[model samples]
Target chain A: MDLVNVISYSLFAIGSFFLVVAAIGIVRLPDFYTRMHAAGKSDTLGQSLILLGLIIHEGASFISIKIFFIILFIFIANPTATHAVAKAAFLSELAPWKKDGGKER
Target chain B: MFLQVALVIVFSSIIALYRAISGPTIYDRVLAVNVIGTKTVLVLVLVEFIYERPEFLDIALVYAIINFIGTIAFLKYIEKGGLT
Candidate 1:
């Protein structure tokens, strides 16, 4: 494969790895607060990296242009959504998961 | 390559679905939906490339917008028990 192809594919692989890892975290993590870490940063980074790879592959096309905007919007929008969800959960007085035998905190 | 990634993501989304269904609280379900939304956007983009159809990009962008707005609105309603 060409050098550009190699780089893009490697990026794609790494990005997908992170994406799957984060999903597993969402499934396996013990708490909503803990799952936020998995859902927020890692997911955004993985999606961005994959889109970045696509940009490298497309190279100055309209597709790349649209992808760039999508990445920008996602970076801006996801954190806002995550924060809103967390805040709403907190405000509702949802109990945080306990470590010392799942008893009331 | 796009197909493989798409399949993996679809699988990941399915795993996330387990949490959505059995989650101890609404926040977990909302979080799961958010995760699934991200997956949906990426899959749309990948499908565009895989099928050589450019129009899917616009759909992907629109989906992203709607997902963000929907999540925010849902949180607001949940937090205050009203849209106000």
Candidate 2:
């Protein structure tokens, strides 16, 4: 009914949709890296939007400031975490998805 | 409206948790857990409103940091053959 409600609802819906997309990407993607691509990038954005909505709903307060801190932490950590996982996978010599005859254990 | 959005986020969290529980590989499970953590952050903020508590945001902030550290540690453990 109010502006805050409208904005928060929209943000939540969008965030939820993005999260669903990430889930689908995980289920459908053929390899670890591709799955990470979906989960890491889209989910991060989804979280940002959802947090923004919550911050709005909360209005100006100490909590809003803490939410900002959460946002900042996510901005720094999500991508770095994704990178770390990818690097570990590569270093572990896990064979990527193969096309034809080259596939091996 | 806020309630609806929270509902959607909760739905997604359940879906993500399912994936994590059934994931075939450790990485997939980790990915699912990370997604769940992101959702949890949002949920925590929402709960602050429902409970009329400002301090919960501090909990959310701490969880975010912990989740990040946990992810990094898991990755390192996977790479190094053991957690150090």
Q: Each candidate's interface RMSD, rounded to one decimal?
A: 1.8, 2.3
Candidate 2 lDDT, tens digit per residue, B1-84? 556666777887787776688776687788878878877887887777777777778888888889888888887777687886
Error of 2 at A91 (Å): 0.7
Q: After superposition, how far is residue A104 of candidate 2 from its true place, in Å?
A: 14
Worst 10-residue lDDT window for candidate 2 chain B reads: B1-10
State residue B61's C-alpha deviation in candidate 1, in Å: 0.4
Number of the predicted model whose DockQ against the real structure is largest: 1
Model 1 clash pairs are: none
lDDT of 2 by residue, A1-105 (tens): 999888877887787788778767766676777789887899888888888887887799777788888888888888888887777778777667776735322
* TM-score, model 1 to reference: 0.95
- Candidate 2 residues lying further than 4 Å off, grouped into runs, are A99-105
Question: How does residue A9 of candidate 1 score in lDDT?
Answer: 91
Predictions' DockQ, in order:
0.75, 0.59
